[model samples]
Target: MLYAILAYHVEDEILSWSPEQDAAVVAKVIEVQAPMRASGLLGPAARLDETRKARTLRGPGAGMVLDGPFSETKEQLLGFHLVDCATDDEAVAAARKLRAVNPSAVYEIRPVKLYVPADGFGTTRG
Candidate 1:
């Protein structure tokens, strides 16, 4: 199964870190991800920019385009990791490893739901 591990942290607190501090934290993240990558369980992952650079759109159709993130929370989604795990336990274990490196951050793991085509046609199976 495919799982998405969402990383959340206080944007202000992170931005306040010195360059050296930031680099050290990122280095630890890389170290934790290395084994997962070698195991072929890691997929696409990336760190997002601050909410100030984000744009939110809501309402009907294209809706109204707004500045910043949709939510007004101190904690923001900082990044995500896509992993292929055999069970929920395995996915949780991956999240645990990440937490070990950065205890201040929060990780939310969710299973991915893949769409399957039916009868070799364009129809999709729910």
Candidate 2:
């Protein structure tokens, strides 16, 4: 099964980190991911740009373009990791590893409903 580990953190708290602190955190993240990557369980992962750079679009159809994220909250979606695991426990373990490195952040683990493309290229969730 595939799982999405969504990371949430306060933008201000992250921004307050010094350059060395940021580097240390990133190094720890890489260290924690090493085993998962070696096991071929880790997939796409990335840290999102600050929320200030985000643009939200709302309304009907394509929707009216907005200036920022759709919702306001103390914590923002900061990053995500896509992992393939054999069981829920395995996925949760991956989340735990991530949380250990980013102690101040929260992680939401969700099973993925993968989109498979057909001959015509339409998406079907599986």
Candidate 3:
């Protein structure tokens, strides 16, 4: 099964990190992911840009365009990692490894139903 591990953090706190601090945190995360990556359990991962640059399209037919994210929570969705695992326990263990590196961030793990267009986008994961 494939899982999505969502990373959430306070936007303000993350934004406050200096370049060096950011690099150090990222390095730690990479270190934790090394084994998983080598084992082919880890797939794609990404860190999103600041929310201030985000645009939201909502309402009927998703026609309305709004500035910034629509979340009211203190923490924002900072990024995600796509991982392949045999069981829920395996996925949770992967999240635990990530949490050990960045204890301040929150991780939400969920199973994924993937789809890829047939017009050359790629193959589906079903």
Best by lDDT: 3
The estimated TM-scores of all candidates read 0.85, 0.86, 0.86
**Where is model 1 more than 4 Å wrong at Cα?**
114-126
Choose 1 or 2, whichever is better by TM-score: 2
Looking at model 1, residue 23 earns an lDDT score of: 98
**Which pairs clash (backbone N, Cα, C closer than 3 Å) in model 3?**
none
Candidate 1 local lDDT, 1-126, one digit each (tens): 999999999889999999999999999999999999999999777899887899888889879988968667668998999999999999999999999999989998999887242454533653
Candidate 1 colliding pairs: none
Question: Could you tell me the lDDT of residue 32 within candidate 2?
Answer: 94
Worst 10 residues of 1 by lDDT: 115-124
Write one digit per residue (lDDT tens) for candidate 2, span 1-126: 899999999889999999999999999999999989999989777899999899987899989887888556799998999999999998999999999988999898999998342464424642
How many collisions between residues are there in candidate 3? 0
Per-candidate Cα lDDT values, in order, are 0.89, 0.89, 0.90
- The regions of model 2 sitting more than 4 angstroms off are 115-126
